[model samples]
Target: MAAMPPMDDELKALQWRAWHRGTREADLMIGGFFDAHREQWGSQERDWFSGLLQEQDVDIMAWAIGAAEPPARFQGPMMQAMQRLDYLKAPK
Candidate 1:
């Protein structure tokens, strides 16, 4: 397999995507999750999150908030963490 890009560069790209989801709410929910949990992630977690960033923001938000069930691909620990919704800070 080819070498992976430097994680810092990859993570910077992910950060931009997470925080620019076209609406403030999506930005907060997605970006906040990224910020809060990213340090703990390994390759599998990063891959999952990278795939998630490709999903519709409304779908992602719904999954995060428990209003809708995530597809099998998105279920499991990562989604569980997102559902907790504790990472978001109220706007000051």
Candidate 2:
């Protein structure tokens, strides 16, 4: 298997994934959240967000929108932070 990319590269990849999840709604939700919070994130927070990125966009959206309960592994401060949905904005 190929070696894992460096952490910076991994972060960039995560940013890309956040913005390009195949739908505008998912993109806005995930990508907007990433853009809003990534600067404040430490290594642990980054790791948590990275793990979240591995999940399906549909599931992530469901969790974010409260349409479905997030699993225990995804529950906690980081997910709670996301649950706020503060990153979302009214389109001008």
Candidate 3:
């Protein structure tokens, strides 16, 4: 996909909002992403994910929401993160 316009502080604002609001949507997206890739992540990875700052997860989830575009260098990790987000938000 074409790179999005450089976001400057727009992305950061979104991340901050999600974190302050404690958006369940953000948690679900981040949790689902990690859950879907459970096998790929070793125990340490899982621990790291669990220990991540809520703002960090909010930032990643913000990217998946397309509320912010991730940096081009982060595409691969963002893609993986999105996959997990999709699974978590999928219809039960």
Candidate 4:
């Protein structure tokens, strides 16, 4: 049998804080992306999402987060937006 990885207080605290930090970072990035772009997508987007608001939001954001590539139809625009965002985020 393989040896199990040892657990410790330091490791647990590190992971707990890291998990929250990561959650905060993801919320900031993805939530900001939604606040920044959801309005700009137009009625076409609204209509498309009209029935599936829950999934649509997550799907679009997952694309922006690099969690998964957007489908072909979404690739061009989201990629363009992501590029612009990347530029805006670059150090002066």
Candidate 5:
């Protein structure tokens, strides 16, 4: 049997969804972003990220890749932070 991942409930839930987003690209973008930043996020940032999780993976990818503009409500520091894509690793 496989060992379970260690995490608190909130973080476990977020990480699960982040890595399981419909596409590998979405997973890398969202999951990598979460891994890079989760340690430093505050309550409001967590809430905002939770809201972002409700969006479709395609839309999220589009926004992150600049293929489409994020909706007005999603346009702000957090979205801008996502747009940076600094968390994505370079291919080896």
Candidate 6:
């Protein structure tokens, strides 16, 4: 296969991170979110997701599911969308 462009390469890395979070639940939540929304993301959204991927899976999950409050930086439309949890799909 041909190599991806630089931006595509970066997105692929982010996608890998989202889908390989060391647990089925986290993979589904984070990866599903990525798959559902990535096509529309501009640089700002991608940067937000990149920062989020650096955080612990438990903290990300907790913030997404309302188990704990997110930091001020993470409190915004993106987190709100994650909490909605409408994007997750079961693997076939």
Best-fitting candidate, scored by TM-score? 1
Candidate lDDT values, in order: 0.93, 0.86, 0.52, 0.47, 0.87, 0.92
Residue pairs in clash, model 5:
none
Off by over 4 Å in 4: 1-22, 47-62, 65-68, 86-92
Over the stretch 3-71, how does candidate 4's per-residue lDDT look in tens digits? 545545543433343233235544444444444555355556444333222344456457666788666
Task: lDDT winner between 1 and 5, please give it.
Answer: 1
lDDT of 1 at 70: 100
> Which TM-score value belongs to model 1?
0.90
Which window of 10 residues has the lowest lDDT sum in candidate 3? Answer: 10-19
Q: Give a tens-digit lDDT track for model 6, residues 33-78.
A: 9987887789999999999999999999999999999999898999
Error of 5 at 38 (Å): 0.7
Cα lDDT tens digits for candidate 5, 1-92 = 56444567898898898899878888999999898888777788888888899999999989988999999888998888899999899899
Model 6's TM-score against the true structure: 0.88
Show the colliding residue pairs in model 1: none
The number of residue pairs in model 6 that clash at the backbone is: 0
Judged by whole-model lDDT over C-alpha atoms, candidate 6 comes out at: 0.92
TM-score of the candidate numbered 3? 0.45
Model 1, range 6-77, lDDT digits (tens) per residue? 458889899899999999999999999998888888889999999999999999999998999999999999
Candidates sorted on TM-score, descending: 1, 6, 5, 2, 3, 4
- Each model's number of backbone clashes? 0, 0, 1, 0, 0, 0
Candidate 2 lDDT by residue in tens digits, 1-92: 56544457767988998899899999999998987788777888888888898999999999988899998889998788788998899699
What is the full ranking by lDDT, best candidate first? Answer: 1, 6, 5, 2, 3, 4
lDDT by residue (tens digit), candidate 3, 1-92? 56434433533343344334456776566545543555455555544444443346656666676777665644565355664445665556
- Could you estimate the TM-score for every candidate? 0.90, 0.84, 0.45, 0.37, 0.86, 0.88
